[model samples]
Target: MDDTGRTPVVDLRLDRAHSARIYDYLLGGRTHFAADREAAGRILAAFPAAGAAARINRDFMARATRRLAHDGMVQFLDIGTGIPTSPNLHEVAQRIRPGARVVYTDNDPIVLTHAAALLRGRPEGRTAYVEADVTRPESVLGAPRLLATLDLTRPVALSLNALLHFIGDDGADRGHAVVEHLKGALAPGSTLTITHATADFTPAAMAEVGAVYARAGTPFRLRTEAEFRRLFDGWEFIGPGVTLSHRWCPDRPGDALRATSAEAACYAAVARKP
Candidate 1:
């Protein structure tokens, strides 16, 4: 690791656009570079509510983490953790359960640079960052930091928020296969939380949005409601079944009213392994 805590061999790759950085740009974060900004602008043009959708997805993660922590879950494994946004998963989980142990995994090296921010949590809580890709479940599940911080035998809260869309279905790295691999590693009672982009609401706009990402060298597959729900097959839903991102376990009355389905453009749910 370098002085910045980033892996020496991991290239920042600022010339090309990365999905995580593009997401950071959409969330109005400063960690994004010019390539990410350019792709985000095109995405906004394709879907005017892109920024709102990103924010709604982020809120769902916080709600899911809080719900899991309140339900007596102390170990968390959050894959595809993007740039360190304030009130991150560890912050929300630790607030509810101060001793919550969180393992954050991401493929982006830029995220590795910002891992320090992700590591800072309440003294009683434990936070670790694993630089790995979700496509190879073993890389994340078997990470040293992850194994040291979380007990896979215990009930864990696994979150994959606004991430699966970047993984296409036709690749050898199939999205469902990867998810199933991770799910199979967890013990029963482990909770899975997901917020995935979908075309169930605005098909044409989402298709255009996908095209924008494709042009930027990123794969974006917007699943339908049925397809998204299938990702949680066999898991018992915690609250309302798969719903719009903003509609899932809304903390405030206005939270559900905050965004329309088309604006949120994402499906969210929390389910437990049965």
Candidate 2:
């Protein structure tokens, strides 16, 4: 609560590597520490294109946010929001619709420490942060801050970019179930956007990368295209359907062509609740 008037729960946990920090490191963010860099190095050894995958996934988030905002969606609920990356979901959405409302939730305390950056949105819009885990969707959806910033009755654009893969199947298809529960809660006409890691293109390399995250005490489950598609079950796809992260509504001429499927290693899509 230093100067931002927000008290951050400071459990730094610099001793072990965190998936969020590793992703921040890969995305060339400075919020990571030494342990994060070491784990990122091991992941890079297994999958050299990890950095590219991270960037491509982030670009997909930006594109999805812009599309949703441009299409007249005003409320955004971004669960598993990572470290404050520039042009964040709120920034992208607010830029398109200044009155857009965004609520970001993440489990990491570091992200809470930097949550101030996420809250800095257009004056016409509203932004809020909730330090909560995605596994417990109830906690996130019922958070006071989230409720205050977003109207549950409105069509909210829910973004789960590069997040679901961390939730292992656990023999019950828990990840998909959680997503379904969340989707059920949103209003009709709401949108669900996701970008998840997949081993379809480079199984061997991705397996090694999964092993690294496993060793780091993180559950890394790379799903297939069919499994990825199931997450959006009962919803209608926006356009182009499910595709590689880089190929999902590319904004620039060479954006989609810049990364191969193996290099991107993630599947992305946007769908409406209808």
How many residue pairs clash per model? 0, 0
Residue lDDT tens for model 2, 1-274: 4223566569989988998899999999998888889989998998999998899888889888888899999999999999999989888998889999999988878888888899899999999988888898998898887888888998989999888999977798878988998999999999999999999999999888888888778899889999999999999999788999889878886888998999999999999998
TM-score of each: 0.95, 0.96
- Candidate models: Cα lDDT each: 0.88, 0.90
In candidate 1, stretches whose alpha carbon ends up further than 4 angstroms from where it belongs are: 2-6, 171-173
Q: Across residues 1-274, which tens digit of lDDT does each residue of candidate 1 receive?
A: 5333555787888898898899998998999888889888888998999999999999889888888888999999999999999889999999999999999988889998898999998999999988888988998888777888999998989999988988876755488888899889999999999888988888988888888788777788778889888889999999898999899889997889988989999999999999
Q: Cα deviation of 105 in candidate 1 (Å)?
A: 0.4
lDDT of 2 at 57: 89
